[model samples]
Target: MTTVRAGGRLRPPDTRGAHRDAPLPAPPVSRRRGLSSSRVAGWGFLAPVVAYLCAFYLYPLYRNVDLSVRHYTVRSFVQGGAEFTGWDNFRQVLQDPSFGTALRNTMVFTLVSIVFQYAFGLALAVFFHRGFRLAPTLRALFLIPWLLPLIVSASTWSWMLNSESGVVNYALHLVGVGRVDWLTSPSWALTSVIIANIWIGIPFNLVILHSGLQNIPAELYEAAALDGANGRQQFWRITFPLLRPVSAITLLLGLIYTLKVFDLIWITTKGGPGDSSTTLATWSYRLGFGSLLPEFGRGAAVGNLLILIALAFGLVYVRVQRRQTT
Candidate 1:
């Protein structure tokens, strides 16, 4: 405190501290350095993910887009003198007769697979949610289709649906029904592939929907039951509404998976019997690498179409989700 003498009385002591007693401002350089280090550390942590996306996702997408717009023969694809064709490849694909069949087949395959997979999955989830002695065992058994390798499952289905000696035909013979060409005729071919896909996808839905069911409060169901709701009523009122978010995600994922399904179709039917069972996925592979002379541009265009379809569905889901949240 500063003391100054007055004529008659002592001046009041100064309460404020001197400049030397004041705290120093923090060094901005150090603060800036700290922020820089933190930012670097954050980016360091994110670098791997970014790199992975670039290498595995972004680069391939770029290449696919490039391929779709260029006239790339096998040699040109490798040696890099492909002429740009803009949308010519897309036009060619649209003009082809197979495009209509492939488009229709793709839609049918995706929608049918998603519908049956979700329905069967929800049913199984509900059934198991009731609990039983063999619930775990039964659920595990049901996952056999999902857990098996695609090749193995597709091959097994191929054998079971074989026109001549398939067990399906044998079982049908036990009844009054005769052998049906599951994979040969155009009418049955897409259905056969869809059936196989549904089997493969059901367990996934079951697992996800069951988990979602677990999240729904038991009290809700109990309250509904006490209100005289039967099983079906309780499911509709309590379960289905609560399960909508899960169902949306499951359906979206299934749509994406079923859209790009190539291995199973290729392994089972090879898009055979004259493009009868051909979906966009199989058709893309056929155009790109199915034979000696690959139509790289057209094939890439088909793949781009598939990507667009998936993207559209994804955008729709996001919009719906946003609306629900709001």
Candidate 2:
């Protein structure tokens, strides 16, 4: 440290450098105006995306809400006519037999998919979190199912699970377990669809959970080990608790995606073997476009219901996030 001689006595060094090195003052008014202009330009660049969402997502959503409260049919679709029916459409769809089946199927499918996906994903994430030979390659390979397009995956699975001569039933027979119809049967159709969904979703869960696991500090695990904590204990008390945010997002996204799944179910069973596997999305399509005479109002009503459920889940996610921050 430097010293200064003041009045012939040795004195401490000048310490004003800290303050001298402080941040500069705010920019000039003209520069501030430039920043405002930049922000406007940034938003201007986003104008097309904003307009696109409004034109497609928002407008379609608004129409769905409107259609839910109206009487819309083939005539209405063709000739542009709809009469406001208040809650009649909602009531009718809610009371309909197929709607109940769809609701049940949706709940079962969503819950089962989420459970198996998260469980298997978490296991893989934890397993692969540690460094190992070929870890990256194996992890990348696991993502193939998720990367495959829904329609292609569905068709491939359809062939694999064909009741008469599919590879799945063939394997079962080879093992003396007897052939089982993977689809086309009312009892097994939903199960088959759920299985495909679970398989397709596992990669997503694995990636997300693995990333979350990685974000956790290694120091915590070292401390836990020093404390004589076992792997399971450390996971529950340390890993799981710390990974809450990522888990929340993963589950939320899974739920949203699972709730709106259409192509998988459509290509697999078409909500069929007598509507046994019908979820809200499939059921809505069935009403609006699958029938001889489209029940557009009913379809819209179901869609709105599904949307409301999704909004509820979103609200829950927001609350959980807020709590986490607090």
RMSD of 1: 4.2
1-326: candidate 2 lDDT, tens digit per residue: 88889999999987799779989998999999999999999999999999999999999999899888889877886787788899999999988988778999999999999999999999999999987998999999999999988899999999999999799998888889977877998889999999999999999999999989988999999999999999999999999999889998899889988999999999989998898899999999999899798989999999999999999998988888888889
Models 1 onward score TM values of 0.89, 0.87
Error of 2 at 300 (Å): 0.9
Could you give the C-alpha RMSD of every candidate to the true structure, in order shown?
Answer: 4.2, 7.8
Candidate 1 stretches with Cα past 4 Å from truth are 1-34, 321-326
The prediction achieving the highest TM-score against the true structure is: 1
**Highest lDDT scorer:** 2
- Residue-wise C-alpha lDDT for candidate 1, range 16-74, written one tens digit per residue: 67656988988799898999999999999999999999999999999999999999998
